[model samples]
Target: MASGLAFPSIFLLESHLTEDELESLKRQIRSLTTDPGKTDVFLGKLSNRERAQFELRRLGVVTVEKRQSRTRASARADTDSAPNLEESPAKRRKTGARAPSPIVISGSSEDDEPVQIVPPPKETDTIKVVKLAWFTESVARGEVLPLSDYTVYEGRRLLAEPAIMPSPAHVSRAEGILKRAQADAAGSQQPQGGKPHFMQARRKKFDGMPPPRPSLTRMTTSEKERVENLPPIPEFLHTTYSCQRPTPVHGPNDKFVEALKTIRLARQLMGDKIGIRAYSTTIATIAAYPYELSTPSEVSRLPGCGPKTAELFREFQNNGGHVREADDDEADAKLSVLRLFYNIWGVAETTARSFYNRGWRDLDDVIDYGWKELTRVQQIGVKYYDELQELLTRAQVEAIADRVLEHANSIHDGFQMVIAGGYRRGKALSGDVDIIISHSDESVTHLLIRRLVLSLEKAGLVTHTLTLSTANSERGQEAVSWKGNAPNHGLDSTASGGVGFDTLDKALVVWQEPMEPADQEGDKAGETQPNTNPHRRVDIIVTPWKTVGCAVLGWSGGTTFQRDLRRYCKNERALRFDSSGARSRVDGSPVDLEGYYGNDPATDMLTAERRVFEALELEFRPPNERCTG
Candidate 1:
């Protein structure tokens, strides 16, 4: 095989010598793909230069000369061929007439499907939109209504944030108006129920709509080709019913589930096709700009605007959707509703729809109806429901933390306790208070915990309790000695068998009980959003002192932060840390931080803090200061 010349496309040039050389050289090339057995066959025929180009291509990279090869040839062809002149083809389906809008179906209450979704661009300030005449009347057509009146989920979460797709009702209304206008353009009287004067006002609003179109006339690169190949509207895919969140919490949360589902569906319909930029970061960057540029080119001067991505933004803004295809997207519609309902606690897909159909729209109705009818725990749930809805302020979090510490101190000597959640996070607010309790004397800790809950409840601080008993040291040793022994908590072998987050206790209680319930479903399924109750969340855990570090570390985190921490701990530190314990990944050697070691919860927190700091070699900082992106 030649090492100097480039290879032609697989579909194009082939020769006996090339084929023979390909087979011979194939024996030497290594395969990286899953089909390892076939790598050499593709590599055998290529010359060294071609192989180099192929490797780069394999990495999703296109070489300059390779790109230039087609482009230069095309340029020559374009010079020879007459430039085709034509209007952009219309996207509205024209099978004698346009189609109707689609009816969206979000998932059940227990499901975590998105009800509504905003199609935020994966790139710039542009949305790929589809334009068409009003859908057929037979379809479920509805207009996007005002935010406050319509849903529990915000538009960002509840509906397909289609840049230009009108609700069925809105599209019909617009179509009716436009038909009259088009008729007026020809020679005709205005249609009945269609007031030309009123349409003019609506038309003014329509004309002021955002513009969109993307063009990559900047630098020529393979990335440009990649961008050109991608359409703005996402390709429709298979659907599945899955829970987005499974919080074993009590409350009316149906509306929230629907909303969340809608959000997911809309996303599936939109920018999922192209790109991976952070939305908050992207929005912040765009928002910082002084002037609004509807097209991507206008903002090309800004940093991070790759030529290919910029084209996409410009095009998205100009067009209501992708360059073509105006079929009513059912996926987006379904997602819109799901997103609307998922925002509420205890809300799921099925319950959200029920509430929507019954016109029991808001949180208030559910609270009034379900509070008394739900479980005692759920009844307590309704009491603090509103307070829980609000993110806790820093002061409120502190008060909760002190209350948690009070219970911890009383548990036993050498018992340790630390307040986590948003308060320890140093954030100004928190959703719920988290308390981690542990003790060095693992043998008697469970006994202390049981007593602690009873006392706290009697003191009126602990409103509800969920206990998950764990194996003592002796019990663990005995289990290991036995051929088959399992912790009754039902945690898997790979993870904790203990219930809850760990072998822990969970409780939800309001500081002040404003209203007591009779008999009601508390945290029951398919519950509606609360309207009458003020409820809040509270989580508590008790791990032994040896595992205290892991418990605290897990507790003091944002989602992504925790993810990265785990990666670092496992991959870099080769450590295993769970709510129960922190041990060596290679061998279960216990991690012991001697300083401040104790069965006392307070001392345990200090020791765990010190241990983590030492392991990471970082300066000692309170949980509040641990926030990391």
Candidate 2:
């Protein structure tokens, strides 16, 4: 019989887990759940307490340190608190008794000693972060183990973060900016056609009055009248999951969605993960909304759209369909510089912030100041920043896909490919191309990415190899099954192990078109010149035939669509869905929903993807219809 965990629920922090390793852990812990709110313990391959705390913080689980253990508390406080105190003379007089003096053993006066204060006791429940080995060892012994030896941290999870006290400089800067904006507003409102004296008096009047701001407050109408005036919320909107409904490429509220996206981008640059998620949820909900928002009440009617969201919508309507924060965010100098650094291929938001803190303002600054400090991939990113930022046309993307397919087929026959990412989601242009390749023969797919990338490099199509991972192939192209019976995934903290959910044999490369012969109009007419094609980012993924359906479905949708799909799978089907494949959460078995629809391997990718939707009991949404922006 399987033993229950010592903790009520466990949250697996996704730091260093391959497909198989994740399944193995889930199988061992029967109480594993995705929501961090309900989790009592966090288990991961954590190094120290700081990392454990950071993982919790990243998931929006704010926490505070609870009271120390009795042993530690006693050591920190005075050994004899009762003997350290002396009664007041006034109290002794009132009681008609002599006061006892505090004992001073070191031949010093009692008044010479400093006072020691004790803090109040904490009453919140303790949250534990234990090492992964503890659980495995416990399972091996067929019993739950004590967490003392393997515990990394013990704290109390905060319901919400405490209010932060801003620094003096921050407050001063905010005041200065507000004052400047008010001055500008006053200047713009001054009369231009009046005489000098009249204009002077009008300016004086404006200076004494506050700038006219738009009203963002909700309407004071009764609930009955409000409901009668507002449109009924759609049935699909009732569900917060985007995967349950179709989100088209473009919606009636694109303008509002774009405005919200700008704010979200600003939040990303500022390293506000929680803010980014909040804005992303708002944008996805609005993108999936079918009606054009006419009133704040209508916006409020949408699910996940509360009074605050409605106020923002009201502000947008009052300001001629523009969010004030979005405009301000674009004009902010600090954000603009951070945005520039963040656009580099190898730099994440945190790295971008680091660059800003290091006083590097632009690509030239990065090259001149931090060239030696950069990673190989970061150096390449700086070298071709502009070329990589250029968007690729549909024709260019198709041509690149064809070239990749050609190289792939030459290495092995009977391989099939699907163009995923924004292109598959019906975008006219994409920043990069994502190609998911597979074959019916599992042997043929083994370590195929390395050979394909080599061929492309030899053909002069691949300029730079950013990262190459063979995790899937190294595991023998088999779907991860949890029964405590699968082989070790054997992943480490290396680039080759692959990061995140896309744990397939893959290569991230900088691709450029091969040089074509160009006729010169000058003295050297007979000589051929190099083609001036721009470099593009490309990701080549190799999946086994059985799970190709999951791979395609995982990579084909928008970011929100993919996130919500995984959430839906976890919440509804008790399955974990990723680009690699799906696994049952209850027993860690491979959820076989792919490659069962057809005999031909060439057309199996798409049909298999549809089969995943059917098997999961979800409405089959086409790739183009998954634009959950």
Report lDDT (CA) for all predictions. Answer: 0.42, 0.74
TM-score of 1: 0.42
Q: How many steric overlaps are in each model, in order?
A: 126, 1
lDDT of 2 by residue, 1-629 (tens): 23454545789986766568888677767778899888778898886776787788788876666656578668567555546556697756556544333322210222222222222222445788889887788877777888888889888764331122333444544564466457656775532333222111121112123434544556655634765776677788788788877789988988888888899999988977667778878888888888777777778778777777888887798899888999999999999999998888778888999999999888899999999998888898889888988999899989999999888889877888899888988889898888888888888988888889999999889988988988788777766544332222321111212226237788889998866544333346655555577888898888988888888887787777777786687669877667777778777877777644345443568887887888889899988788877
Clashes of 1: 126
- Cα TM-score per model: 0.42, 0.66
Candidate 1, residue 260: lDDT: 26
Instruction: Name the candidate that leads on TM-score.
Output: 2
Point out where model 1 deviates above 4 Å: 1-33, 36-343, 346-384, 411-416, 466-500, 503-535, 587-604, 616-622
